[model samples]
Target: MDLQESFINSPDHHRIPLLSWAPQTPTAVLVIAHGMAEHAARYQPLAQWLNQHQVAVIAVQHRGHGPHCPDADLGHYADKRGWQKVVDDLQQVVVHARKQYPDLPLTLFGHSMGSFIAQAFTQKYGDQIDNLILCATNRVDKPKLRASLVLVRSIKALRGKRHRSRLIDNMTFGTFNKAFVPNRTSHDWLSRDPQQVDRYLKDPLCGFSCTAGLWSDFIGGMLDINPRVWRKDLPVHLLAGSCDPVGEMGRGFSRHVTNLRAAGVKVASERLFEGARHELVNETNADEVWHHILNCLRPETHSVTE
Candidate 1:
C-alpha cells in the first residue's frame, strides 16, 4: 500500500510529513517515531502488516531528519533546539491523530532516539494513548559523561569552528555499527534472516552519522526520559535486543521492572531477543517481533513472556 504524507504547518509552516495506512477493519492506530537520522518511511513494512490485521499507522518525520531539514549541517541538534522542536512536532501529530481517529485505540511506537521522544510524549500526553511501546531505548549514563561531552564541545568551539569535532563523535558511537553486528554481513541485526541486514545496508536512508552535539543531546534526552522521570502510569512495554549494543541496559531494565510495576503502571511485557539488534520491528524475525508488539496494543492479547 502507498502512504500519503501531509505537511503539518506549525507556526513557520515547517512541512512535517506524515505517512498513513488505513485499515479495513480498523482495530487501532499505531503512531510511529523513527530513530535518529532516519525517516518514517522505513517503518512501512510494519505499517503494512498492521494494516492487513485491521490496524492503521501514522508516522511522523521529525523536523530535522526529513529530506527538507532546516539545517543541512551535522551539528544542528548538538544543542537542545532540534530535539525540542521534534518533540513539539510529534505532539502536534498526536493531537492531529486523536482528532482523526477519536474512537480507535491509539498506540505510540518508538525506536532508539524516537523512544526518548515517545517516553517524553507519554509524560505530557499520557491520556491520549492507550499503549506506549519503546524499542532499543537508551538509558541515562553518569553525570560525569554529560560534563565530558560539554567540555569536549567547548574545546572544539575554542578552535574557532562551530560544533564538536566530527572525528571524535564518529569514533565514540559510529563504532556501534561494528560492535553490534561485528561484520555487517555476518547476520542482519534487524531480522533473524540474513537478507534483512542486507536490505538495511543497501537502503540509502537506513543509517547515517550524527554530530557530537547531536550525540550528547540524544543521551541527555534519554536521561530526561528515565523511568525515574516517567510520570505516566499508562500500560508500557519495553523491548530490547539482547545482542544489540544499544541494549547495554538489558539487565538494568530487568532490575527495575519492579519499580515500574509499583508506579501503578503495568509492565505489560519486556522482551530481549537472544541476538536481535537495535531495530526489532524490522528484524529477520520481524514476524515474531511484530506479534509481541501487536499483543501489547491489544489488551486481550497481552502476555508477560516474549
Candidate 2:
C-alpha cells in the first residue's frame, strides 16, 4: 500500500507529522526515527520495503527536523534539554499509535542519533514494546570525554538560546575517505552502499549539519542514561560494524552488548558486520541487514498468522 500522511498535535502543543504505510495483511508495526538533521521521510524506501513484506510502518518526524521544526537550525531534536522532550514525543506517538491500532504488535527502530533516542525510549517504556532495534550507536564511557562534550555543548547551548546558526555541519559521518575511513567510505563513509549515499545526497531533505546544541544534548543524554538500565528488561537488538569508527578502539561498542547481557536484558541478538558503515540500513549489504531485521520481526518457529 502507498504511504498515507498524517499529523498529531503534540501534548506540548507542537504539530507532529507522521507517515504510515499499511500492507494487505499486516504482521506487525515498525516505527522508525531518522538520524539527526534528516526527517522521517528519508525512510520511504525502508517503509515501503517493510510494507511489501506485510509489515506496517509509521515514520514520525522528530520535533525539530521536519515540518514541525520552527527554526531551520533546529530540527526534531535540539540539544540535551530537548532530548528528553524528543523521547517524550516519541512515547506520545507510540501511545497514540497503540490506541489507534490496538491489535498490532509494536516495535521501534532507530538509526544513528535516533538509535540513542530509541535506547532511552525503550528504557522508559519497556513494557510497551514487543521488540526494539538500535543501529549504529555507541556506549558512553570515559568521563573525560563526556566532560569535554558537556563543556563544549554548554557554550553551544548558550549561543543557541540567543544567536544560533541556521545550518550545522556534523562530523559524526565525516567526509568519505578511504584510508582514514573504511572501504564503504568510497561509497559514503556513513553507509556502505554507494547508491544509497547517492540518493541521500540527491535528496534535499536527507542531509544537514546538526547544531552545537544538538551535539551537546545528545552527549548529555548519552551519559545520563545507561543502556544497562533497560538492557535486561527489554528485548533489544543492536547492529554495528566492526570497522566502524564508533567501535574503533577502547569504546568497545560490541562489549557493551555483553554488558547488556549481564544486566539480564534479553538481547535478541547482536550482529557485527565486518565492513559495514554507520548506516547499515543504507549499506550495500543492507539486504543482509534487512534479512536480520526480518528475522527479528519473525523469530524462529514463529509464523505470521495473518
Candidate 3:
C-alpha cells in the first residue's frame, strides 16, 4: 500500500488538505468526508484497512478541521457561503481522485456532519460517484432545521459569526453525553472503546466548538436536501448505531430511511448495529463494521445483508 498527502485549491483562496491511501492495484476508490471538529487523518486506520481490500482511499479534510488550518480559522468553514464552499471542496477532491484513478468507481463515505455534506454532494453531483455511505446521520425535518437556522442566525447577528455559544454547544455536544451518566469523558457516546475515546480527546483537532455561522450553514445544508435531487441509480447505504444520540437512537434512521424510500430510491440499504454508538468506525466491533462495509462494496453476487 502507498500513502500520500497533498493540498488542493478551492474557492475563496482556501486550500483543502487531503490524505490518500491505496493499494498497488485498486479495484475502487473510496473518498471519505470526515465529521466536524475532526481531521481526515483520524480515519487513516480505516483507510489502511480498505486499502488492504484493494480499494484506494482519499480522505478530504473538511475546511476548518485539519492540522494545516490556522488556530483562528479552526472552526470556520468560510466567511460567506460556507456550506456551498465546503461542498465545493469535496468536489475538488473528487475531481482530483478521478484524475488519479479514472477507471475505478468511487464511493463516498460520510460520518456525522460529513454525512450532511455528502447528502448535498450526491444531490448536486451524484454522477461523480457510484455509491454513497452515510453513518451516524440524523433525519432532517424542515421545521426543526428552519428553527435552528433562525436561532443560529439570530445569535450570529448579535455576536457575529465568529462567536461560539456555550448554550448551543451544551444543547448539542453536551447533551449527547447525558445517556451515559457518570461519563468517563464528555465523548463517551462516540464508541465503546475506552482507548479510542482517550485518543480522540488527546487529538488537538478532535474537539472544538463550531461557530454559530457554521451551525447555521450546516443546518441550511440539511434543509436544502431535496430527495428528488438524488440519483435513483446510485446505491446508498445508511449506517447507524442503535445507541447513537445523533441518530436519535435509531428513530431518526427509521424516519430518514422512510424519507429516502419515499423519494423512489431503488437500492437504499440500511444497517443498524445492535449496541453500537455514534462512531461505528471507531467502535469495539469496528472490524465487523468494516467487513460489512466491504461487503456492500462488493459485486452483485455478494451479500450485503450481514
Candidate 4:
C-alpha cells in the first residue's frame, strides 16, 4: 500500500488534512468522513484493508479534529456556521478525490457525525457520488433534537461560542455509559474491545467536550439533513452495531432506513452487527465489519483474507 498526506484549502480558508492509501491499480476510491471527537488516523486499519483489495482510500480530518485546522480549536469546528463548514470541508475533499481518480467510481463512507454530513451532501451532490456508506447512523427526532438545540443555543448565548460546557456533554453522552454499568471507562459504549476503549480514553483529542455552539450547530445540521428528501436513485448502505446506544440499539437505525424508504429512496441496504458497539470499525469483530463494508462496496469482490 502507498500512503500520502496532503492538505486542502477549505471554503473557510482552513487547511484540512487528507490521508490517502492507494494500490497500484485501484478499482474504486472511498472518501471517508470520520466521526466527532475522533480523527482520520484511526481509519488506517480500514484503509489498509481496502488497499489490499485494490481499493483506494482517502480520509479527511474534519475541522476541529486532529492536529490540523489551526483556525479551529479542538472540539469546535467554528463559532458560527460550524456544521456547514464541516459539510463544505467534505465537499472539498470529494472534489480533490475526483481529480485524483477521475475514472474510478467514488464512494462516500461516513461514520457517526460524519454520516450526518454524508446525508446532507447527497442532497446537494448526489450525482457526484456512485455510492453512499453510512455507519453507526440514526435519525434524529425533530422535537427532541429541537429542544436540545434550544438548550445548547442558550448555553452558547450565555457562555460564548468557545466555552466548553460539561453540563451539555453530560446531557448528550452521559447516558451512553450507563448501558455498560460497572464499566471501566466513560467511552465503554464506543467499543467492546477494552484496548480500543483505553486508547480513546488515553488520547487527549479523542473524548474532549465540544463547545456549546458546536453542539447547537450539529443538532441544527442533523435536523436539516434527517428530514430532507433523499435521491431515489442513489445506492445507500447503512451499517450499525446493535449495541450502539447512538443508534438506539438498532431500533433507531431501522427507523432511519424506514424514513429514507418513505422518502422514496429505492436502493438502500441496512446491516446490523450483533453485540457490536458505536465504533464498529474498532470493535472486537472489526474484521467482520470490514468484510461487510467491502462486500457492500464491491459485490463481486472475493471474501476477505486473513
lDDT of 2 by residue, 1-306 (tens): 787888887666766788888898887888887787577877777778878888888888886687546666454264336778888878877887787678988889988778878878887887787889877766656675576686656667667632333332333444324425434433356665677777777765656555666666677777676655674655788888765675552146777677777777788878888788667777777777777777777675344332
Candidate 1 clashes between residue pairs 3 or more apart in a chain or in different chains: 78-213, 190-283, 191-283, 191-284, 192-284, 192-285
- Number of the predicted model whose lDDT against the real structure is largest: 3
102-139 per-residue lDDT for model 3 (tens digits): 99988899999999999899888989988899989988
Screening candidate 4 with a backbone cut-off below 3 angstroms (N, C-alpha, C), the clashing residue pairs are none
Taken over the whole model, the C-alpha lDDT of each candidate is 0.70, 0.71, 0.88, 0.87
TM-score of each model, in listed order: 0.84, 0.86, 0.97, 0.96
Best-to-worst ranking by lDDT: 3, 4, 2, 1
**Which of 2 and 4 is the better model by TM-score?**
4
**Candidate 2 versus the native: TM-score?**
0.86
Off by over 4 Å in 2: 67-71, 76-80, 142-145, 161-171, 175-187, 249-251, 301-306
Poorest stretch of ten by lDDT in candidate 2: 162-171
Error of 1 at 182 (Å): 5.2
lDDT of 3 at 211: 90
